[model samples]
Target: MSEKNREGKRSARERLAVEREKRKAADKRRRALIVGASIVCVLALATVVGVLAANAGKSGKSSASGPATAPSGAVGKDGLAIPVGQDTAKSTLTVWEDFRCPACQAFETAYRPTIRQLADAGQLKVEYHLVTLIDANLRGSGSLRAANAAACAQDVGRFGDYHDVLYQNQPKETQDTFADNDKLIELAGEVDGLNTPTFEKCVKDGTHDSWVQKSNAAFQSGGFSGTPTVLLDGKNIYADQTITPAKLKQMVEAANKS
Candidate 1:
């Protein structure tokens, strides 16, 4: 080949090599940008999740003053309803509930039988904590009213029966039916001796209103996120997704054995 042709070929080869290197560098930059963007997205998502978790924890905590004083006949000092079992029961089941919460109603309806049986059998003591989250969310007084009426029932030595009746006759979440004192008295009639003049007076006057507020504050301080939060011997039963309504009896039995 001629010298001039050889030189031209060499220059062409060099140009092609340079172009290939440029393309490789460009691809590297694009890949780097893509990786960096993916990492940023992941970090942002993690931050959001962390914030949400923190908020949830904060929402669950109870107030500093703790739960209100238990009513005259209530079993515990913290305004909880009278426990249904013997004082030496093997397990303590603490339930945080809202009268207007559908989930709370569902839990009551589904687990009432098991809970009642356990209590009656003296295997466990069930403590009820009334909260007013629904009242705050729905802008109604039903939750507070119902809780107050329940406390009145406690004063009359019929808290458990009245509590069950309240759940059995719970109004729809959107309806503030329990807000009516007459309705509360009517429901009280379901539990014998709970519809007396004094009981009616208590409901009408919201005698336990302050107690209900303290109960809610206690619930917040408890670090519970929502209604029907159940604790077995002070440990959260629903925390790990292992316990369900059907498994509650078994869990109680296990706790008793343990």
Candidate 2:
């Protein structure tokens, strides 16, 4: 072969060799990058899982931390559904209460948090039915007025807040007289976004008087001899001696599993 042709052939072979080496190096770098990225992804996922496990353990040790329950079935005549949680498909609880009853007030204070938690969790539902069984004075015009006021609050989409505030600001049973029209307006004012004029008109006109009667009818049919009778998913929640938060929570938890 000629010297010039041989030199050209050698140059071509050297170039091919260099190109192969460069290709091999690039492949190695890409593989390394892929391997490194996979490792980082795995580590990140493991770290997230570990954090979740730790948080769950800590929550299990605490009293306040737990799974939320549903409360979808708690439909009230006052347009107050369970405010804190979603409701389950089959689980429904009902609360029959008399506004002036002290035991009802106690239940309101005690079981409210658990109810809110479970309701927010979407595991349980709570319905409220007003019973006029506190005193003779509360039965006639007084009970009707209060019950209608609550209904009017419901009309304005402030029933839940109004219900809570009413129980929170309940007067001593010995005070004899319950909330008058002025007091009802004042209590209604405590709830945000409640139209005072409309509520006042409803209360004055007894807009929810029929609702009060229906509640009474339900109270009678449900066999609630008194106020603050709680039914869990249809069955009555027994409060033998004292109605407590723990007991109420237990009731809801039991219902949740079933």
Residues 67-153, model 1: lDDT tens digits: 344567565556455466677889899887887777776667667888888888888898888877766655666787788788888
lDDT of 2: 0.55
Query: lDDT of all the models against the reference?
Result: 0.68, 0.55
> Least accurate stretch of 10 residues (summed lDDT) in model 2?
55-64
Question: What tens-digit string does per-residue lDDT give for candidate 2 at 1-258?
Answer: 999999999999999999999999886764344222222111111112112112211101211123311122336543333332354434667776666666666666656787787777777766677645543322223444566567667666677788887778776654434436667777777788775677776665555555565555555555445556667766666344333457667766776777
lDDT of 2 at 24: 90
